[model samples]
Target chain A: MKRLLLLLAFAGVVALMAWGFNQAIFVAPTEATMGDVQRIFYYHVPNAMLSFLFFAISFVASILFLAWKNSAPERAQAADAWALASAEVGVVFCSVVLITGPLWARPVWGIWWTWDARLTTTLILWLIYVSYLLLRRFAEGAQMQTLAAVLSIFGALDVPIVYMANRWWRTQHPAPVFGGGPDSGIKDPTMLAAFGWNVLAWAAWGLMLLAFRVHVERRQQRIRHHQTVAALAGK
Target chain B: MSGMNDNSGSQNSSSKNSSSKKSSLKNSRSLRIVVAVVVVLGTIGYLAYTGQASAKSYYVTIPEMQKMGAKAYSSNLRVEGFVKPETIQQDGPNVRFVLSEYESHNPKAQQNPRQITVDYRGSEPPPDTFKNDAQALAIGTWGQDGVFHATQLQAKCASKYAPAQGAATSGAKVATNEAPVVAHGNRTN
Candidate 1:
């Protein structure tokens, strides 16, 4: 049953990824002027959004872990595992966002990068999560969890501020191209359909990765706790 | 007997809490050092990235450019203003014109726009029918010597190019026969 469940999950992820790839790079129409390369938006924007979301969740989970006053070693360990999963996924999504965003920007904005708020905040968000991972490696046990949680909260606070800074200052990054933004033209039906499907596919991909990472984290915690208990017994 | 059991339960809970606290603190000061370093390095790295970005030029409108004056406007610039109808002179391969400046925040000012001269040395401009009074952007440089040299020119194409929502239209390329206004000395090739 376990093997079957794993197989179904893997197949689902593969299907979602294939659909996402088509929506992102294949089926989307070429931009009128840029010609054939504007489809990178589907991957770049979604990954960027997901990276921010994972980090935000890490922050909330950390807060709950610290505040709930749970005394069981298992509870603390589970929270650490969640932190680990969030940090890993956050890093992956941030990397994808960084890479694909530059590819999209080069053709349209005519520069590989700008000092725009979204870009800057994203870089900061990436660093914050990298720090979370490094903190995990260097600090272990209860204190490590507490410190990571505090940092996660701090990092999440930066997201809104970063988004706001774009409007507060001059930005080179294009504003919303779809949705209800003031500059957004009406999206044609075909484009809208592609965008909707891509969003669903991306969500599936993110959830699949999150599930895998969380599973590994739980396993690691179990092993580590067993080792600690063995060591105490030996002493 | 009930009271005794309740007291023992309270003691067990208190002992568990103290034990967890003791375990957490018993981890050596080395853990504290690690946290400090990560926080410090993370903060420094984030600040450095933000600082480098802030030093780069942000996009500015033509009015913003005007406000920035000669000293502050140095990095690659994108200026949007109105095409000055009279200042537009098509000289051979180069077109020279002025962009009428306006506040960057006011898109409504596009209707009664001032003109700026753009000298584009590219292939022929998009089309002759392109409006003389349209909002435009000249993507290039404003020299320290105070002239703007444009490599590209774009006049915002309005709804005139397309048929309204449900109208059927046949495709036919129309000829645009505009008189050439070459500059006095540079009309070769």
Candidate 2:
């Protein structure tokens, strides 16, 4: 039954991705101004939004790991696994956002980069999460997980700041397409649909990636437990 | 009996020596961590400081740029306004244009808007989005000749590009006339 469910979910995600690709490239009208180059918006924005979401998930999981560490170590390990998985996926998504953004900006904004509040805050956010991942990889002490948890929390704090940067400051970055005041949002229904389909597709793909990572992490944790027990028995 | 006592004494001292060495190693490790954190934070702070100081706002209004007077000429400045329709002239990589205070695309906006001329001599060509009524930001220095001598030019569609009502007929023009501008992609003020 579980195998069937997993297979179904995998199929569903693939379908969603196919539909989204069609919507973004084929169905959606060529943008008025930048033409096809504007289509980068479909991929770039959804990735950015998902990256923030995954980071938030990591933050919550990190807090759970820290809180339950002493009383329920097994639960804490599970939470830590989740935290690690989410952080890894978030970084991947963030990398996509950073890369895709430059591609769009070069033709539209005429510059590949700027030091506006929005861009700067986003870059900083990526750096903090990257450092968190590095700490998890290299730091071997017993307190490494705890340290990474604390760092994850700090990194999550930047997420909100990044979202708010353009709103609070006039940036080289464009204002939010939705809810950015009077003139914001997609005017054409087709454009909006294309954006919607891509958002669903990318998010589903990201969630599946996160789940796979968590499963791998949990298996590794269990193996580590077994190794330690066997080593102690040998001693 | 003396030999046995000496052996025990040596063993005890050696254990003590090892423990102290371990403690010192741990201390240095933590000290290194603290130093690393401080250095990373300090570097980010310094970079953020310099980056923001160079371009404090996305783009300053033309009046604000004019008010800066001597400061505008001495330091880097980013001035934003609507490109007056038909004022854009390109010569190789260089372009000359006029910017107006109000949204040029908006029919309801002020007709005789405050205007400034821009002389953009950047190595790179202006983006394809640069066109009539587009919102353009020019970055460089104000010359003594009263022209904004731009080292760079960034352009996007005005906010009026929204295809609110009647996107089928009018929306084509609305969406096509002005290209999609970036959100949060901005300037060196």
Candidate 3:
């Protein structure tokens, strides 16, 4: 029954994504300045948004891990597992944002990349999460969770900076479409609807990925515990 | 067998308790490391913040660039203006053009608006969108010799996306004929 539920969720995500893809290409009107290449905005913005959401989740989980470390070790372990899973999933989405951004910028800005405030901060955000994942992979035993949790907290500080980079500085990257000021915003209703659909679909998919990753981490912990017990018996 | 299982379970709990104590000790040491890491990251963040602030260049109009006078000549800057009709000259691999504060197509704005000569000698060729009356931004330093020696050039066609003036209901249609602007070069300011 659990397997069936997982399968159903997977199917739902695929269908939603397909609908989003159709909306982006066929339904949304082409942007005046960028034409069809602006279609990448549908995928790029949502990926960046979901990545930020996942990093925020990791930040909270890391705090919970540390807060519960002594009083509730089991709860702390669960929080640690959650932190790891969310950070990994966040990095995957961030990578997609980074890649799609350049593809869109190439035609619009005439350059593939720039060290503008927004772009540079986003790159740093990706790097910080990458470092968090490395700490989890190579660091040893109980100390590893503590160290990884600390890194997650540190890494998450970049999230707001990335979002505000464009607003605070003059950048080649366009201003925010939603809250950007008098000069900026989506003028077309269809464009807004398409962007909304894409964001919802991607967010749902990201949540599913996060849940599966957390489950996998818990199962690995159980297997490791069993091995430790067998080794103690032999000794 | 049940008794044996109970004995192992108790053994596991005791081991877990002892290990947890050990972990708490290690946690203190890890906390110190975390403090050190935070200090390093904080310093880096501070330096980056200041550096970006000092390096940021405002997008000034041609008139504003003149108002900047000698300061504009020294500092890195970006200026947006419309390309003057029939003023573009190809200089070997380089291109030179005149940028006006007002659109050349606007017959009523100013017959001869404030203009600046831009000599683009960057690594990449001028984008196909670089044509008469195109809105363009030049990123580089203004030479004392009076020309803006642009290391990078970006151009956007004016008629491409007619953004509705005041009416919230007016729809925008993408222009079909123009080639997409291509920005090339490693020069970033």
Candidate 4:
């Protein structure tokens, strides 16, 4: 019955996500100036925003783990699991942002990528997370946790600088889409409402997925510890 | 004191042994394979996405557009510079014109100043300000005879007006210095 309830909840969320996505896709008209290509903004912008949120989570969890070593091992273990979960989700969103961003750029900028501030910073953030995951896998117990946390916090620091530099650097890509930047392309009430709802829906979905992943991880860790203890007793 | 020291030493040794066993279990072939696959796929996907996005903007200057010959003219491209006076032609829904850099104040220069003629079949070009001496980006195909046939025209708005000049003084005034570029012919539509 518990499993069934969880399944039903997951399905309900998926349906909501689909409905919200359709609202963003169809309700919004092609921009008067940019034409059909502007539709990429609906998914691309939200994913970028959410990716940063996940990266932030990874940084915070890493800090908590490093500072409170004397606390029960469970707390640090939980934080590590959550941090990895967030990192995996973040990497996926970063991938999407990297993809759709170029699609929108091709027709307008005449190139697939630029050394623009936002693009470079996002790419760097992606690389830092990649290294964080690697460090976790290779290092030993306390060392792994400590190194991953330090790397993560430093990486999160880069996000704000990336945003600021994107503004400060002169690039062909327009200003913020959803925000009231130069490209306030969205004036329609239906479109704005749809964008807002979809961002919220996706963010919630991502958090739920992270939670589920962390739960599984913690259970697996407990099983391993129990097995180790049992095997020692047998010996 | 020796008993306590021995117990501490044994505890440390046991913890080290256990951690090494856990580390050995983690370094399995399957784990390595999973990591490799994820990294390889992610990099390839990133490259492909970036390639697709950078394909659209104008890639050449006016002179470069002129040199590429007939095939270059047919491909959709962006060409920049000032719209040349007296060379613009309108026939039915199509418009043909040459864009050239103004030869400065000097009249006697070599090589007829590189220009592109556009065969534009799009909307009526923006007002008189969209004519000679105005900076514009013309999107369309170039013609065999050096015309850039623009399907779309984007003109840079005049930027010299000081805020102090105010709209009341210059807003209502119409430009009457030269004959409008469209005087020669009209669009059939």
Candidate 5:
């Protein structure tokens, strides 16, 4: 029954993604100024928003892992698993954002890149999380999880800085298309609809990926536990 | 009694020697720590100072640029202003244009504003979005000739991404309704 439920969820997500893609391409009006190039916005913005969300989940999980370390070892391990999974997924989504952003910017901004605060801060965020993932991979000894969890928290802090980069500074990047004061936001309902659908689809997809990663990590942890038991018995 | 005094005097000297050695070691370690701290702080201070210096203002407005006097002419800087109508003169990748404090998008904001002439030469053609009423940011040095000599130029569309007039206002539901029909046709093919 659980497997069937998971299958249903997967099917639902695929359908949502297809629907969102259709909305973005066909339903959204071509932006008057940018024409077809503006379609990239539907993809880039959603990926960026989802990256922040996954990082936020990772941050909370890390905090919980730290809090439960001594009192409940099992719970701490579970939280640590969650931290690693979400952070890895977050980096994947952030990579998409980083790649898609340059693709969109090259044509629109005329230059492939700029060192504006928004772009610089986003690059830093990606680097921070990439380092976090690396720390998890190669770190040695008992305190590895603790160290990684702390780094996860540090990485999560960059999310807010990335989000507010444009708001706080004058940048080559444009102001927010949504919630960017008055004169900002989608002028047309159709574009807004397309944007809304893409955000929902990408978010659901990211969450699904996070769950699968966590499940795999838990299994690995159990295997490690069994190996340790065997080693103790041998000794 | 003499033998006991000799042993006691030697013991006191050795004790004094070890105490001095320990004190010297502690002093050297503290000096090393102080040097390390100063180096770390100096690096941080240098980075912060330079980071703020470059990033403090992404671009200066035409009015502010004008007020800067000779200082503006000396350094590489970015100045943003709205492109004046009918003033674009294109020369391959290089262009001559006039920018004004009067934003072409919001005419109601100012009737007449300050103006500046810019000369831009770039390796690539000016961006497609460059046009009359567009906001342009020119990065280079200001010149004594009253023309801003620019090595890099960037433009923002005057419309700023408002949808085109035709089908943009149509209901989203109506468009999606047609999407399935197109998909089904493609499947048959």
Candidate 6:
């Protein structure tokens, strides 16, 4: 039954993605200045949003893990697993944003990359999370979990900076589309609709991926516990 | 009775051993948490201080750049200004243009404005939005020959979004100047 549910969810995600792509390519009107290249915004913005969402989740999970460490070890362990899962998934989405951003910028901004505030802050955010993942891989034992949780808490400080970079400083990057004052929003209704569809699809897909990753992490922890028990019995 | 005492003694020793091991584990865990907290706090403090310092050196406007005088020539600066009308000369992928300190929405505002020449020899061709009276930000340093030698050029589309406060509104007229560049397509050199 669980397998059937998983398959159905996967199929739904695939269908939504296909429909979103259709809307982006056909239903949305071409931008006045950028024309076809502006279509990349549908994917790029959603990926960036999802990445931020995932990192936020990781931050909360890390806090919960630390808070529950002494009072309830089991809950702490669960939080630790969740933090790992979310960080890993966040990095994947962040990678998408980084890659697609340059592609869209090349034709529109006439450059593949620029060291503006927004771009630089985003790059730093990605590096911080990548280092978080590496810490988990290299560190061992319960200490590893504590160290990783600490790193995640520190890494999350970059998310707010990244989100506010464009607003706080002058950059070649475009200003925020959402809440960027009265003049900064999509004028076309169809483009907005396409953006809505793509954002929903990507968010759903990201949640599904997070769920699967957490499950795998739990299984690995159980396996490790079993191995320890077996070794102790042999001794 | 003796057997019973021996069994109880063994049980006491086993419990004591387990208790000691558990206490040691707890001690180490608490120690690790303290160290982790210190390291994390130190890192956050360092990053916050450095991030603030770097953010302070953000882009300067044309008037501000001139105010710095000799200091502007030494520091790598981003200068924001309006593209002077009819001053854009394109050669292959390289572009030479003039920037003015006028922030007016009117294209005629280019007349008699304080101007500076810019030579853009970046890897990418100028964007289609690059045109007369557009708002531009040039990232590079001032050269010895009284020109801004830009390593990067960015042209804002005025019609799509409102120009930032103090930036010229001439960007709105860029649509008319965009046709020729779109036909040529952006080239990277």
For this target, which candidate reaches the highest TM-score against the unseen true structure? Answer: 5
For residues B1-189, what per-residue lDDT tens digits would candidate 1 score against the true structure?
A: 577556656787877577657757856554896787688668856765675565334444665666677643475566666565466777775777767764233565456654345567777553332334444556677776566667766543221111112211211111012122211211111
RMSD of each: 9.8, 8.5, 8.7, 13.3, 10.6, 8.3
* Candidate of highest lDDT: 2
Candidate lDDT scores, in order, read 0.61, 0.80, 0.78, 0.63, 0.79, 0.78
Candidate 6 Cα deviation (angstroms), residue B87: 3.4
Clashing pairs in 6: none
Q: What is the lDDT of residue B51 in candidate 6?
A: 61
Runs in model 1 lying further than 4 Å from the true structure: A69-73, A178-180, B1-57, B67-111, B118-146, B149-189
Query: Which is the winner by DockQ between candidate 1 and candidate 2?
Result: 2
lDDT of 4: 0.63
TM-score of each: 0.67, 0.80, 0.76, 0.57, 0.81, 0.77
- Cα lDDT tens digits, model 1, A1-235, are 9999989988987887787676545444433323344456666667767777888778777766765536665675667667678778878988998898777665444456765666887788888888988998887877878888878877777776555554444455544454424434323444455566776777777778888888888988789778999999995
Q: What TM-score, to 2 decimal places, does chain A of model 6 have?
A: 0.97
Each candidate's iRMS in angstroms? 11.5, 7.2, 7.8, 14.2, 9.5, 10.0
Clashes of each: 12, 12, 1, 15, 0, 0
Off by over 4 Å in 5: B1-56, B108-110, B157-160, B169-189
Q: Going through the candidates in order, what is chain B's TM-score?
A: 0.44, 0.56, 0.53, 0.49, 0.57, 0.53
What DockQ does every candidate get? 0.09, 0.17, 0.13, 0.04, 0.17, 0.12
Candidate 5 docks at the CAPRI level of incorrect
Over 4 Å off, model 3:
B1-95, B100-115, B128-135, B155-189
TM-score of candidate 3 against the unseen true structure? 0.76
